[model samples]
Target: MAVLQVEKVSKWYGKHCALNEVSLEVPEKGIFGLLGPNGAGKTSLIRIINQITGPDSGRIFFRGEPLKPEHVNHIGYLPEERGLYRKMKVGEQCLYLARLKGLSSADAKARLKEWFERFEIGSWWDKKVEELSKGMAQKVQFITTVLHQPGFIILDEPFSGFDPINTNLIRKEIIRLKDEGASIMLSTHNMASVEEICSHIALINQSKVMLDGEIKEVRSRFKESIFELSFKGQMLSFTNALGTQFELLQHSSDADLRLARVKIKQGLTVNDLLQRAIPHVQIESVSEYIPSMNDIFIKVVEQPEEQMV
Candidate 1:
């Protein structure tokens, strides 16, 4: 089931088009990655979803109903740009934001206490927001964002200022939230994080969605049918036997081992390539080279015209 849907959404700033006919569906209880390079209109689309701005053309839906002011209560948004009152104490600020999200005073306090304890920041509650480091301040903002238990959450560059340890901490919390039935949309340039945490993704470029699907399906769509083969053998005989069935993209040799990256030609399988080479070389291991998310990101963004063609 989809928790949020953007249908033919378009947004403009003055005469510049920020988003053009953008559309995507975020399913419930899954992490959806909104991926793109800088100035790709991702932020514009996010702002529209948050109701921070209106779309020039198109509509949005929340849980199958038209998005409205009341639906804001069902959303917890942590924008890329951090916003918190510098003079306000951590606990007080959190409580204030929680109430704004429709939580009662008593309930807000109870939830704040629990989150503070879980985050090991109980002592920092009384500290002013300005006195805390960026990461600590981010923790406070994160706690307040989720304190009301909103059904949908949008995190833009959530790992920006954290160290590896804290980054992992938040990543685990995101997975936990999904498990407990919260749908999340993660917007970031970090392909590693997307690969590790996202179940589905939509890649946007030039103010339009270039690709969108489950992670595995999208990855499979970009595969190049290349394989890495490690073996101990004579390179010439091996290359000779395989002939044109497989194109050796790269070849290197050491004292006793030979490593070659081969691309399987059309109508040729790994088994067929192996059959031709088995009589000449000792095969140690063979594995396909599946493109990583980072590789795919660079490839897609670098060839926008080719993708459209």
Candidate 2:
């Protein structure tokens, strides 16, 4: 079942339209990526989802029920722009925020302790927020955001301030949360992370959803019939064998081994290409090349709006 569903939701700010009939579904117990370039209305949609503002048109549903005010308590949000009370101690701030999420003081404290230790930042608990580095503060904010054990979590640019180690740490935590039955919506420009973590994604551009689907399905939908071949043989023999059956897009040689990327001709399959090349080259490996999320994002965003769908 979908954890969240948006139906033709639109939002406008005076003369400017921030979201134009946007619609997408975030499935239950998995990570959903909300992707778009800056100024593409990602933040606007997020705001509407969080109830920071109402949509000018259309409707949203949470688990089949119309979204309402009480739903806020079941949703946790960590925005792109980090906010914290610099004067407040890290533990103090976490406790306050946790309570606001409806946790008892004692429960909040216990959860905070567990989170701090898990993040290896227990030593910073008594320190003021101002004393912590940007990354450290980010970790604290993340703990509080999920402290109340909300069923759904919205994280925008969650990896913004972390180093590679911390980034991986957060990535693992996100996966763990999903395994524990929490639906997560992740918004970030980091396509590599999205490819690694997102089960599904929606790409928005010019205030509209250009594409949305399961990651593998989307990649297959845009695949260009390209394949990579690794073989030990003369490059000339391989190219000559390919002839009209394939278009050699790229080729390289290292010692006795050679590699080539070729696009199979229409009506020709991988087996066809293999049969044709096997006689000329000693085939080591053959794998189809799938476009990365980064490539798909660029291609979709650059296409004309009318062609995006």
Candidate 3:
């Protein structure tokens, strides 16, 4: 079941259309990457989902039912712009937010203890938010965001201010939450993170969805029939062997290792290229060059609207 569904949702501010018939689904227990360039309506859509703002037209459903104010309790949102009472104690702040989500004071305290321990921030309980570093404070906010164990979580730039270790830690926690049956909507410009943790993605551009699908399927859709070849033999021999069966788009060499990117002609297979090249060059590896999410994002966002498929 989809944890959240947006159907032909449109939102306008003055004369500016923020979301134009934007529609997408956040699958249950999976991480959905919400991708788009800055000011591309990503924030607008997120706002509507969180009910911070309402759509001007269309509808939103939460688990097959019309979204209502009560549905807010089932959602946990960590926006890109993090906020916390700077003078408040870390544990106190977390407990307060937990209760706001409908948890009783006792339940909230118990849950906060477990989460604080799990995050190894038990010692930070008494520290003021202002006393902590940006990353430290971020960790506190993250714990509170998921403390209530909401079924659906929306995280925007969740890894911001995190170092490599902290980033990986959060990434693992995200996957763990999904494994435990929580659905997540991850919004960020960090394509590497999206590629690593997202099961599906929806790309928004110019107030519209330019692309949406499973991660692998989306990447596959942008493939150019190009392959990367790494060999230890002469580049000239490799090129000569390929002949017209493949077009060598670019090549480079480092030490004895030579790498070349080639696009196979129509009807020609990888086996066909290997069959011809085997006699001339010692093949180390050959793999298809799949475009990364970053590449696809730039391509989709920059391409003329009419040219998109």
Candidate 4:
């Protein structure tokens, strides 16, 4: 089921078209990745969904109803640009944001304590926001953003400033949040994270939705029928075995084991590739090479204007 849907939304900045008749859906549960390169109008669409700005055309629905100002309380957003007050104490600032999100003062304090402890930032509670390092400030913002436990969450570049350990900690928390019944929208350039956590995604390019669907399905849709193999074989014999049935895209040798990628000929299955290789090479293992999200992102967004959506 969909938690949020944007229908034919369009936003124009003066004469600049940021978003052009774009539509997207956020699932009822699990992470939905909002993917696109810079200047693709992802942020514009996000703002419209959050009601930070109104679209010049189309509509947005949340839980099957028209999105309204009150719905903002049920949604939590962490913007790419951090917005904590520099002079406020970490704990105080979090409480203020929580109150703004409609949390009671007592409840905000309790949740803030729990989050600070979990994030191992309890000692920084009294530090001024300006005194904290960038990553530290990021941590405080991250905690406050989700402290109210909203059902719908939008996180933009949620991992941008953290070290590797903290990044993993946040990643784990995001997965946990989804498992605990919260749906999330992850907007960023992190293709690897999208692959790891996003169950669904909508790829916008040149101000249009070029692709949209479950992650696995999207990857499969762009498959080029390539396969990777690992084996100990003579390069010459391997080439000869392939004959005209396969096209070698890449090959490399590591000691005795040879790694290569080939495009399967039409009407040929993976079994065919293995069948032809067994006679001439030791076929240790083989697997289909599905293109990564990064590959698809670059491929779609960089194409000629006539090719992109």
- TM-scores of the models, in the given order? 0.94, 0.95, 0.95, 0.96
lDDT of 4 by residue, 85-197 (tens): 99988888898899999999999999888998888888998899889988888888888879999999999989998899889988999999999999999998999999999
User: Where is model 2 more than 4 Å wrong at Cα?
Assistant: none
Q: Model 1 clash pairs?
A: none
lDDT of 2 at 29: 93
Task: Residues 105-222, candidate 2: write the lDDT tens digits.
Answer: 9999998889988988989988999998888888888888899999999999999989998898889999999999999999999999999999999999989999999999999999
lDDT of 1 by residue, 22-131 (tens): 99999899999999999999999999999999999999999999999988889999999987999998889998899999999999999889999999999998899999
How close to the true structure is residue 44 of candidate 2, measured as C-alpha lDDT? 95
What shift in Å separates residue 255 of candidate 1 from its native position after superposition? 8.1
Clashing pairs in 4: none
| Overall local distance difference test of candidate 3 | 0.92
What are the Cα lDDT values of the candidates? 0.91, 0.93, 0.92, 0.91
Query: Which of 3 and 4 is ahead in lDDT?
Result: 3
Q: By TM-score, rank the candidates, best first.
A: 4, 2, 3, 1
Q: What lDDT tens digits, residue by residue, belong to model 3 across residues 226-299?
A: 99999988999889888877999999998999999999899988899889888998899999999999999999
